[model samples]
Target: MRGTVAHLVPVADPDEVATIIAASKRAVGAAVESLHFPLVPGVAAAIAETDNAWRALEAEHGLLDAAAVSRMLGSRGRPGALANDRRSAGKLIGVRRRHQYLYPGFQFDAARGRTRPAIPALIAAADDAGLPHDELALWLCEPSGQLGGDRPVDRLDDADAVVTALSAHVGVQW
Candidate 1:
């Protein structure tokens, strides 16, 4: 990395300097992400199991890509309207899987093509609890003791129950 910087960046223009810094930071981040760390056999197996479980869950139900979500949302005049709305009010449950983020299909009412009413409060609670979105996605897919062994995704319509469960979680992984 020390030897990687062979070109001098323009320092006279603050904007140009900032752009260079931002690009370099992104490159560093990409480098870090691309690195392969040593993994114990046991840990590797556990990770594989977890990933398989998640894949099974995703396959059993369904995952909606952003385009699918936007399509279901119907073409509004504004691009990324669903994201904008969810950002402000937490109306959706989205999670990253692999290279792209996918939304849980159960989050929406299939008939109406709209987000389930109960999703907002639950998403908001999950956000408040600071649970990583990916964990939330996994949590929703798995059965919960709090819901009497029912998966949160299955009980998505029960806002009170889900929110209560989320509050009880207090940001801890489910």
Candidate 2:
């Protein structure tokens, strides 16, 4: 409802109008199936929440596409393979956008040619706490009073501090 809709001429010819209507019908059906049909109950809400989460992340912390992440990692591997490897290592996580992966730039230090050491541990903490990726991303970008009003990513240099924050988040020591 918030997105742009194209304007079209309403044809006077019955055959042309019917053809256009048929095409519109098919397009609407496909859009509905792609947007909602595959989602289970409650997933639609999560998706909507994550849309805001992603927007917040983009505003505060720039995101990198799969290719950029791969280049930062110093890997010549294909983007998908690199993503899988990072996921397996618990060192990197990305959100999917229209079949493409977008990695958070904060997770890696391009100068180091590797993901920040705290990333994997923090990712594990988030997983153990059952926090979804979008929530984690948002939390990481938000300034915290406990952190002296610094974002969690800003304190990445101090792994203990980041882990402490995550531990407090899940109400457990990690």
Candidate 3:
């Protein structure tokens, strides 16, 4: 449920940005519904439940190293601020590859920059949760081919498809 909230304006076309935004909203909404809960949960219980589930999966799979998660989150600088921001951390995968990355709400060192593929982080996280890794990886990376310096409307559609597929694969409500 925790996500970044900054508005992402694609460098392509305004119309494309609008389309991407709409598709993103629909995709996220669908994902939330598939999960049987809202993307941004209103109650603490929901958050705790999700967190506990993730933690339990992590303990079970050992796919993601705690050091990696800690390092990634810590490297971002203002972890609290980033969490409050509604943007998907996974989105950074594309932004990092396409533009001068700026997590507006977080206090990270813009200079250090990103070193690994953002999609990998999501895969690792999912893996640690005992989730299907191969399927999720395909879903997450499917959009990369459509994304570039151009308008991301097409990529956004691909992303939506990926998220929708992932939601279904994970038995989440979308």
Candidate 4:
């Protein structure tokens, strides 16, 4: 992606820039269109299976619904501040289930009295990879052989490792 963007950097001509921009837009459009193409019969089932596994994992780890999170954070009723943080700062990510959002409890950095600083970067990397919120949370909490069986959340102290792991998970160099 950087390589694609870098091709436009040296261009000083307005027309050339416009041409590059148009090409970029076309490329992005094709990518987006590809996502909507019909999946193989087993692919949708596989995704459903993966989601079920993640849900079981989430149950084991325990999750906090929006109201529960608001109560735990001592900011009951609407959780406007936390919601804002999720959108504006990427400090938190919520998975929607049954029309309500559920937050992962581990994301709250009790030791620091806030969400972990590295969370936003992780979220960004996952977003770039097109990972959904629930799957992202499950990925963070589950032990991975790639990290010597360490859950990604446990490596939050090392932001670089988390970023690398996220990039690797998404198969991007980042």
Q: Judged by TM-score, which candidate is best?
A: 1
Ranking by lDDT: 2, 1, 4, 3
Worst 10 residues of 1 by lDDT: 1-10
The 10-residue segment with the lowest total lDDT in model 4: 1-10
lDDT of 2 by residue, 26-91 (tens): 865676687843646776446645665676677666778877777777778785578667866767
lDDT at residue 146 of model 3 (Cα atoms): 30
- Writing each residue's lDDT as its tens digit, candidate 4 over 90-169 gives 66777776676667766776555566777788888888888876778878877866678898878887878877887887
Ranking by TM-score: 1, 2, 4, 3
TM-score of each model, in listed order: 0.68, 0.64, 0.22, 0.59
Candidates' lDDT values, in order?
Answer: 0.71, 0.73, 0.39, 0.69
Evaluated with lDDT, which candidate comes out highest? 2
Which is better, 1 or 2, measured by lDDT? 2
lDDT of 2: 0.73
Clashing pairs in 4: none
Question: Which stretches of model 4 miss by more than 4 angstroms?
Answer: 1-48, 76-81, 84-88, 172-174
Where does the lowest 10-residue lDDT sum fall in candidate 2? 1-10
**TM-score of candidate 2 versus the correct structure, residues matched by position:** 0.64
Counting clashing residue pairs in each candidate, in order, gives 0, 0, 13, 0
